[model samples]
Target chain A: MIKIKLLFAIFALATAFASSAAADMAIIVNPNNAVTKVSSDEVKRLYMGKTKSLDDGTRLIPIDYVDGSAIKQEFYDKVVGKPLDRIKVYWSRLTFSGHGRPPETLSDSARIKAWVAGNSDAIGYIDTTLLDGSVRAVLIVK
Target chain B: MSRWRLPLLLSTALVGGGATAAELKWDGFFTSTYSITNTKSTYRDIVHDDGSFDDSRFGLHVVSDIHPLWRLEAQLFAAGYEDNYATRLDWGFASFHLSERLNLKFGKLKYPNNLVSEYYDVGLAYPWIRPPHEYYSLEEPSASITYESFSGASAIINRRSGDWDLVAQPFFGEVELAESDANISKFIGIKLSASNDLTELQASVAQGRINAEGHELDDQTKRIASLGMHTEWGSLVNYLEYAVTTFSDSEEARTKAGYITLGYHFGHTMPHITYAGFDQESGWGQQSVTVGVKQMLNPSTALKLEMQRITPQLNPEAGAEMASGLFMDVPEKTRVNAFSIAIDVVF
Candidate 1:
């Protein structure tokens, strides 16, 4: 009975660690904004800076994590179907040609939430565990 | 020191309290290439050299969103093709958004054609040290029309449906190039591209009137068409392009060029192979095979090493001169080797 209990304990710990490693990401927008949910394609377009407005003509601002971050890599690899470097290369082609810029980057989740909460047009992402009353969740990436 | 201090103070004051502010974004890129070849003539953007940095170029770009619906952009570009650091305004444009899907731009726009034409100068975006010269070369006896820049008004249409995105642009512009004495008084072209998650397809058609005074035909018009496809699956990338240009004089004088490339990415390294060719009726005919490797230093920097074997295949039966194949001074049916290393960076 003691051995079985220890095995269960180890299994629980491993599950917890796995959950922590693969974080659940949530896309956040300003609470006052009318946007509630966005499809994956809409998110890709916004992040690529293809368009600045939402479906209802509300100007939307997309935020990004700084380079070489774990969550940023996960977001790009999982949601955008591209490596972070490849995405940067795409941006380089546009940015150097004076076409467009990537989204504004923030340092951490706290700062991101603060920025999103203050600006109605802004959007960002954070770990679902960091969810609070300040920003509204728009899309959840499982 | 005073000037720096004043500007710093003003920027701080503007961001701190000012209400009306322009959001400015600045970017820069540089590419330095050194190539060694046995030939004594120029090919594509590079010239005949033992080892020349003449292909090196530096650019600084500034984009300002002065208003939500209006934006201005400019690029200060410096390069030395044959001379020393010559600076020019590469592109400057202002765009006004009519709706979420359409916008109108006015200025000097990058001449758009195939998948890599507009971004051909941006080396870090592609897997090659340089795009295949026989297919993408702007100058000379390679093929037919040259897709460079012009002053124009452009309408850009952007649409997104499901997992695909489409961008179509049509423009009416005036193109003038005095170097080759090929003057284009009026130029009109349209380009349409669709991109899915990992695939992109593009097609373009252009019509132009040559402002010729002593050439083949004065005020004669010609047609150019191009089709391209690019796709990436996992580590493998494929690029294919085919173009044909029809002159006003005769259908036999029409030029054609095409190329295909396959590349595989492994970690920070990507190795690619390409085969391209160009045929012109006036005697110049060339084909090349290029093998290259690109090493990514980081997200914004890369090191590229490439080697190409180019053969100038001129048809003697057509009564063509060796000088028409201007890529090199080598004997006809001989292959010239080009080995190049380039470093590309973005900041």
Candidate 2:
């Protein structure tokens, strides 16, 4: 009975991990871009308007999802590492101070993917399930 | 051409060229606060026994990249504390993005003396309804020297290393104090800041000459230095700042002030406490403790309630003439309590 119970527990743990992995979001860039991978810190800096270019001097145009979107919430939670309200306050500080501008926001993942595919400088995030050949995933946010 | 004609023509051209002109962005923030103190003496021109809305204010910010390398920005602000809520151009500057790491700005710009000096008027940007009075107030009325805006230029340099981002800003300008008709001339300062996801540190120094008509501080050469740190660990937040001001001619005019704040986030609510104090060479000073709670009504709005206890102190060695501490018509030794409620929103 003990052996059977241990096996069941392991099965449950594996299933949970699988589902969590399936729910992950992907930070995407144009497939033609030279960049292949990105760290969570880099993503946060780009999204927060702290840096305007990549390490290789490539100008980065970060794109964000519209407010109140589930994908946007997940990206901010997992990658940006700040709550929505705090993020708003951060952007307000930068915006009003004329230090930086928030990224232009699109409505949905499909539109973001289209924009990223068309513009080599654009970087955005979408659900991993929405992944396609048009854009390349640089980082997976779990 | 008239001074206004150039901007008029530019606006017309930008409006007519739909696809060529960069998109202009408009943002705004508003804050309303009601506060009252138990004491008979007025505080900061607003807090008294009957309550006042003097903390309320509205501001609109506009930005546009008129050219690939040039940006124009301005803010229109109105505050209840000002006479009749008159709207004023709080900041109007043009920025030249010289390179990826360097930028230059000219015109009227926000004074970058302290941590929150640039966005102090934007209540939604900070947890406090009003910044701690000890280190942020004007020295003539309080114990510190701080200015709102200046007319001149600045150069900002950005550097990134590993996870830390660094910024160095050197500026020069002159400021006119509307409340007291004082002027700060030949002002020059440099601020250095470093930040990561969880922590930020800043240090700055400035030198200027203060000239006030019919005031004791006339033609005084003043120097100021400040240090600040802010950090967040999980749900815990902390802020610490210290500043000192000195005069070249008068040792008795030196002042030191500082404040520390701690807050914890519980879901959408945060409870915070701050202890602040200031000491002047002339014996006038005060210590204050504030307890506050902020409730996030939404992503763009917050409602806050705060209660503060202020205790005035005077040093006999410095002299009896310097008895009042940030208050008018108050007894030498009296503690005052104040309560306030505020709402801040940004869009």
Leading candidate by DockQ? 2
Candidate 1, residue B146: how far the Cα is off, in Å: 3.7
Error of 1 at B123 (Å): 0.5
- Model 1 quality (TM-score): 0.88
DockQ of 2: 0.73
Per TM-score, the best of the predicted structures is 2
Please give the distance, in angstroms, between residue A118's alpha carbon in candidate 2 and its true position after superposition.
2.8
How would you encode candidate 1's per-residue C-alpha lDDT over B1-347 as one tens digit per residue?
Answer: 12134234434543443354776667888899898776665655455646677888888777766666777777667776734766656666778977777989887777776777767677898988777777777643232345556778898898888767898999888775624656776788898999886899999988778786886546777787889999998889999988887777665556788899999989878999999987877556788899999998988899999998888766543444434243534443367778889999988
> Candidate 1's residue-wise lDDT over A18-124, tens digit each?
89755889999999998898877678778888778666677788988888778889889878888888898889877865557899898888888899999998988
Model 2 CA RMSD to the hidden true structure, in angstroms: 3.6
Task: Tell me what TM-score chain B of candidate 1 gets against the true chain B.
Answer: 0.87
Compared with the true structure, what per-residue lDDT tens digits does model 2 show for residues B267-297? 8899999999988787778889999999989
Candidate 2 clash total?
0
Clashes of each: 0, 0
lDDT, model 2, position B159: 88
